[model samples]
Target: MTPKAKAATGALTLASAAILGAMHLWEGQRLTVYADKLAGGLPTYCSGRTQPPRPVGSTLTQAECDAIDRQTATEYGRAILACIPAERMDQNSFDAMTLFAINVGKTAACNSRAAHLMRDGQRENACRALAYGPDGRPVWSYARGVYVQGLQNRRRYEMNWCLKLATAA
Candidate 1:
């Protein structure tokens, strides 16, 4: 091969390798962050003998939030993951679903239309099926909408980041 042609090919190969390495590093970082966040904020649950933080009718504090977050993240997260046919949720869904689980509790989200579609192995349909607002727009709660739009936004950003990483990987 000509000298110039050989040099150009070598450069391109090196660039591709570098890009792949960067992507791997990025995905690793994101996954670590996701796991760490869940670990740090996960809540504790005791049996009926133990008193719940609120005594069944009170607002939650940081401790309660932590307890609930941890409990739901584990219980609901596992249940949702099990129902999902995919071996993994592609990080975006992991963070999204876990956060959603933490907020609305497992039973609520697990029983949702989105959950059913997801379990049925309908990803595109499930994504479209998720509703976070009222009157057909993102809202604050379930009085009208699905009530988890904010976390859905978080999932969007996470998925975009993953895609960018994929291109490089």
Candidate 2:
């Protein structure tokens, strides 16, 4: 990355963490609680469409989708926490992981070999695990390696900033 991009990423990372920490400090559990209330249980990325060509559940109403994203985000977060690749992850790590999982998918994110390597404590080798695609396939195939590396880099930044905060505190 260019020096400017790196610097900007650093700034953005800090800002994101500060916001999350502030929310937790002020709202305590309200953040997740409100999200759950809005979800209404059936709130999912699928809305109500159980299959393709079926707009019935493709997208929910605005309120429902918003609530669904929140609820799914929280539920997805719990799964990540239970099986994080690393033993010493902080909330930042978990947040980064959760956000990625939410964006991509829980099953896809956690089952990555790169993720497995990360959990095994091989952060660098884990990065190498980021192949363009397994078996010479394109990212369109199973590019777990590529995305997991990105997630690792993000979590590393979060982990570093978190450590700095802990030390300062």
Candidate 3:
């Protein structure tokens, strides 16, 4: 991890290494701004930031990208800590939810059934809620109202990580 990455994770109460690792694995680095079809063709760059939008052709250095990623992670961490009791959650579970928030957006993740379950002291169920809802149907596995395999795979990965199970390769 870079110094910025360290500083970013330092502000969070959850497990830093795991959270950063998951973010890297899921978000992937993109120094050049590009349209994200899944996000309605919004111009995004630097590990998925869309705010303070950069033009599609804009490019950033690796250090610049890392800095942006760190800032975004810190902001998301604050949001997660505001709603969830990070101190009480196991490292893996908190890490999993942080990744989820990164993917879904802070408000939505904080307002999700998973968050509700965590707040209500249902840890395991909250983890399960990452992929399935009360109806035992998949959730957060769709893009533009259509089921997406990539999203399903991500949810499954998150669910497994939260449960501390062996993740699929």
Candidate 4:
């Protein structure tokens, strides 16, 4: 790789690591939380082996859960980096994409409009795309607009991080 490309890759790697750290700080390591199936059906404790999916009628200690969380998130972050192959990324964009990849999957993250926009050098638009749901709409609620908010808020936070708050520090 050229020096500039190598530099961008290094920056992205650093930013992704920071992003994962921040994610753990925010979410904590849940020993048993149901995640939606990657193939898209219902939310379940078992989605894939990449995540520390809890088995049916199984129990786990805090240490085990934490280890699994770190492992899974690291794997997802690396997948995100791999998906972007030759693209140059800013720190904020890298952080946003890393977090998004961890939440969504590598396939979705790689194929997202946000990813396309980033690749096309329309980063501002890519940040906006982070707020869009899989349906390509902005408002996504877990419940019936009451008692619970959802991924939209998370997406908005990511958008803000990418567009304004994310930094090299």
TM-score of each: 0.42, 0.41, 0.86, 0.67
Q: What does candidate 2 score in Cα RMSD to the true structure?
A: 13.1
RMSD of each: 14.9, 13.1, 4.7, 5.5
TM-score of 1: 0.42
Error of 4 at 144 (Å): 12
Misplaced by over 4 Å in model 2 are: 1-59, 123-169
Q: Tens digit of lDDT per residue, candidate 1, span 1-169? A: 3566435333222112332232233222121111122224322222111123223232445454444434433454455555554333444444445444444456776776666766776555454445432245542234233444544564344334323312222
How much lDDT does each candidate structure score? 0.40, 0.42, 0.80, 0.61
Whole-model alpha-carbon lDDT for candidate 1 = 0.40
- Which residue pairs does candidate 3 place in steric collision? none
Against the correct fold, how does model 4 do in TM-score?
Answer: 0.67
> Worst 10-residue stretch by lDDT in candidate 1?
27-36
Best by lDDT: 3
- Give the per-residue lDDT of model 4 (tens digit) for 110-160: 888888887887778788888864566773223434422446677887788
lDDT of 4 at 74: 56
TM-score of model 3 (CA atoms) = 0.86
Candidate 3: misplaced stretches above 4 Å? 1-15, 165-169
lDDT for 143 (candidate 2): 38
Highest TM-score, which number?
A: 3
lDDT of 4: 0.61
